[model samples]
Target: MNRCRNWRAAAAIAVAVSSWTGASALSQHKHVSDEELLNLLKDAAPASVFAGATVLNMAPDGTMKVVREGNNGWTCMDPSGTDPMCADAGGMEWGKAYMTKGPAPQRLGFIYMLRGDNGASNTDPYATGETPDNNWIKTGSHVMIVGAEAKSMIQSYPRSPKADPTKPYVMWAGTPYEHLMLPVK
Candidate 1:
C-alpha cells in the first residue's frame, strides 16, 4: 500500500513539471504582431521626424543613429551630424524601405537595412551591398528592429542567389549606415 502511494506522488510531480516546462517554451516563442512591434519601438525609443523621414531615435546606447528618407533611401548621421554618408560606387542597399516592416507573426527572425538606391547588387554603382547576416545587429538571438518597408523588402526578397537571376541588394548599418539591434526582454 505504501509503495502504491509513493508511485502516485511521483507521477503527479512529473506531470506538474512537464506542464510548467511547456508553458515556458510557449512564452519564449510567442509571436509579436506588426502593430505590437511598432508600439514596442515607440515605447522603448524616442522617435522624431527628420527631413521627411520618421527617425526612430535610438539613445546613445553604444550604437550610432540611422535615418530613413521615406522609401527613397537611407542615410547615416556623420559623427559631426553636418554631412550625410556618401553613396559611393557601392551605394547603400538597405534603405528605409527595408527596416520598418516587422516579420510576419509566423516568422521567428526579422531583418533591417541601410538606405541606398543601388538595389541589391554589390557591384552596382550605388551598392552598399552588405547582407543582414553581416550586420552587428543580426549577430545574436536578439529581437530585430527594422522599418516597415525594409522588413517587407527582406521578406519578399529571394532567398537563394541562383533562384533569381538578379542579385538582391544587401544593407549594413554602422559602417556608413548605423542601425541598432536591441535585446528584447
Candidate 2:
C-alpha cells in the first residue's frame, strides 16, 4: 500500500525538488552583518550543537562560504533569514540527496530548528506559499529525522497532508523526501 502511494507521489516530488533551495543554494538577498549571522547560532540549535558546529553563510548568488570552523561534524546556518538550523553529517547527506532529487541515503539524519520555521507546504517540498490545495504549515521549534530510516518511521505517525504543526507528523508525506517532523515547542 505504501509502495503504491510512494510511486504516485514521485511526480509531485520531482516537481517540488526543482524549486527547493538547499543549503548550498541558499540565497542571501540583502546585506547582512557577520554579527547578525553569528547571532543566529543561538536559535539554530542547542548550545552544545552550535558550540562545535561549523558556521556557513551563503552569498547573494548562492555561493556558500564558511564563517567559522569547528571540530564537530555538525554545520549550522540560516538557509534563509527566517530559517536557522543545525545538521549533522548524515543530515547533510540527506539534504544533498534532496537537492539533487536522488534516493535517500541509508543512514538516519538529524536536524535541529530550535528557532522555528517560516512555513512550508506539507505536501510539496518546495511550494513557497500557500495555494488552494497545498497544505501550508509553519512549525515552531522542531527536530527532523531524515533519510531512508525516516521512511520506515512514517507509519508510526500521522501522515495527513493537514498535519498538526505542534505534533509529531510526516512532512512531505508519501514522497521520497518525506521525513519525520517532531515539534519541540
Candidate 3:
C-alpha cells in the first residue's frame, strides 16, 4: 500500500512539471520583439505622417522611447504635460505598467506631439486654438510607451478659460490629444 501511494505522488509531480513546461513554452512565443514593435509604430496612422520618425526601444521599466530626425538631429518631445517637453509622467506610467505586467504582444499606448519637418521648435499651436504652425503637425498612435503615457497627464480646461461653473473643463481627444491603450494586434 505504501509503495502504491508513493507511485501516485510521483505521477502527480510529473504531471505538474509537464504542465508548467508547456505553459512556459506558449508564453515564450507570445513575446513581441523590439524590431517588430518598431515596425508597428512606423505603420501607425499619425506617426507615419511624420517625415522620418522611427520607433526607438523599450526602456528598462517597459516604457518605450522614440526619437525622430528633425532638421538637425533626433528630437523627442511630449506635448501633454504642463511642461510637456521635459515632464516624466509618461515614462513613469509606462515603467509602472511594465514592472507590474510582463511585455505585451502589441504596442501599448498613444502619445500626441508636434513633429517639425525642419527641427524642434518652441511653438504651441494647440495652445492658441488655431491651426498648427507651418511644418508642424499633430502626430499620434506611436508605440513609444513613455509618449503614450504622457497623453494621460494633459489638463482639461474650462470653456471660458476662467471661472465657469457649469462646464468645468474641456480637453481635446482623438484630435488634438493622443489616445493610449493596448493595440488589438
Candidate 4:
C-alpha cells in the first residue's frame, strides 16, 4: 500500500513538473478549483502555514488583485494559465517587483506552484495559450517550486523575457528576487 501511494505521488509530481516546465502535452487538463488549490497547499505544507495568508487573483493581463486575507503573513495567488501558488511576504514583495519591472529586492521569498493547469508559455511570462510553449522539448506536464535563495541551492534556471521559447528556468533571475525553477517532475 505504501509503495502504491509513493508511486502515485511520484506520478503526480512527474505530471506537475511536466506541466510547469513548459511542456503542454496535457493541454486537455482540467482547471484546478479553489478547494483543490487549498488542499494542494495543505499537501505541500502544514495548515498552520496558511493560518494568516493573503490570497490574490492574477488576471491574464498580469493584474494581481487581493481576493481575501488570512491570519498568516503568507500570500497566495490564483494565477491564470498556471497552477495556484502560495508565497511568503517576501515573495509577495518580489511579485510586486516583477510586475512593475522595478529594482530587485532581497526578500528571500519562496513560491509553491503545484497541481498545474497548462496555458502558460515557458518562454513568455504571460502567454495565454492552452498549450503555451510550442517549443517545449520534453512535452510533459509539471509545476514550479521557486524561491530567491533556491537559485544557488538548486541547479539554477532562468525565464526568457521575449518570444524566445525556453525550457524550465528560474522564476525571477538577475535580481535579488531570483527564484528556483523547481519542476515537480
Candidate 5:
C-alpha cells in the first residue's frame, strides 16, 4: 500500500515537473499552490508530517514569532520564511541552534524542506538561502534529521546530488546543525 502511494505521488511530481517545462517559465512563477505547499511539507518533514495533515502552516518572512502547532503534534514554521521548514518535537529541539541567530543546539534535531527551496550552503550557517546558488541545489524531496552521525551519511555521498534539484543529498556541512538528507525517492 505504501509503495502504491509512493508511486502515485512520484507520478504526480513527474507530471508537475513536466508541466514546468522550462527554466524561464518556472522562474516566472513562485510555485505557490496548496499542492506545492504540501509537496514542500513532504520533502521537509515527511516521516512526521503526512499528506492528510489537517492544516498547512505558512510562516513566510518570519511573521510567526514562534513555531505554530498543528493537529498531529507537528510544528511547521514556513510559508517561505528563512528557508521554509518544518519539524517534529524532537527535530524542533535539534534545529533550535540553527533556527535563529543562535549557536548550534547541544543535541540533535531535524526539519523538512518540502516547499520553496533555494538550496543551502554547506559551509555558511548564515547562508542567505538566496536562490540560484550553484552550490546548494534545491532539495527536490528530502528531510533533515539532526545528529552528529548524520554527517557520516553526508560524507558517504557526493555533493553533486545536492547541487542538482533532480537528485537528493544531505545538506549543511561545516556547521553545527548538519543533517542527513534522506530522499523520498
Candidate 6:
C-alpha cells in the first residue's frame, strides 16, 4: 500500500535523525552486513513489534536500504549501531520535523529505543558531543512519546534542562519538538 510505503520512508528519516546525533565509537558509520544489522536492530523493540516491522540500514552518507519488509505499521533501524529504535508513523513524522527544525506534528507519536543510546546532550537537542555545560546523558532501554500530547505532559514530568535521563523526563522541553522520554529498564 502507498500508505505503508510512506510510513516506511518516514521511519527511515526518523532513524536518520538518531544517526545524526552524537558520534560514539559504535555510532560511527561503519559498513555492517545486512544480517548483522538486522540482528542488532531486533533489540530496538519487543519481539511482537519487531516480528512484523520493516527494518532499514542507513549509510553514513544518509542513504537508506531496506533490510527487511513487514506488514506491521512500524519501522526499526540502528544506523548508529548504538542507538537502535522502532518508530510508528506519527513518531516518524515527529523525527522528520525535528531533523529539519520544523514544527512538530499535531498528533502524538511513539518511538522505541529499547537497546539504549550512545549518549546525548539533554539540554541541547542538536548537541553532537558531550561538554561540561551540555548535560550529556546515556539512557538505558526507553521509549519516547512525541508531538502535542507529549508536550502537554511537560508540566507533569521533570522539564529541567538538567533533568535526570534515567527517569521519566521531558527532552527538548520548551521547544517545538519537545517530547517525553520514559525509561523501561
Best by TM-score: 6
lDDT of each: 0.26, 0.71, 0.27, 0.44, 0.45, 0.76
- After superposition, the stretches of candidate 1 with alpha carbons farther than 4 Å from their true spots are 1-50, 62-158, 161-166, 169-185
Score candidate 2 by lDDT: 0.71
Q: RMSD for all candidates, in order, please.
A: 20.8, 8.6, 20.1, 11.7, 11.0, 2.5
lDDT (tens digit, per residue) of candidate 2 on 55-130: 7665555455567766677777665656777877777777778867789888898989888877788898767667
Worst 10 residues of 3 by lDDT: 78-87
How large an RMSD does model 6 have?
Answer: 2.5
Q: Residue 179 of model 2: what lDDT? A: 92
Candidate that would win on lDDT: 6
lDDT of 5 by residue, 93-148 (tens): 45444444355454555556554455455444444444455354455555666756
TM values, all candidates: 0.18, 0.83, 0.22, 0.50, 0.53, 0.89
Comparing 3 and 4 on TM-score, the stronger one: 4
Q: What ordering of candidates by TM-score runs from best to worst?
A: 6, 2, 5, 4, 3, 1
In candidate 6, stretches whose alpha carbon ends up further than 4 angstroms from where it belongs are 1-4, 11-15, 19-21, 24-27
TM match of model 2 to true structure: 0.83
How would you encode candidate 3's per-residue C-alpha lDDT over 81-105 as one tens digit per residue?
A: 1111111223323333332343322
lDDT of candidate 1 at residue 14, scale 0 to 100: 21
Q: In candidate 6, list every pair of residues with a backbone clash.
A: none
| 10 residues in a row with least lDDT, candidate 2 | 16-25
Give candidate 4's error at residue 91 in angstroms.
1.0
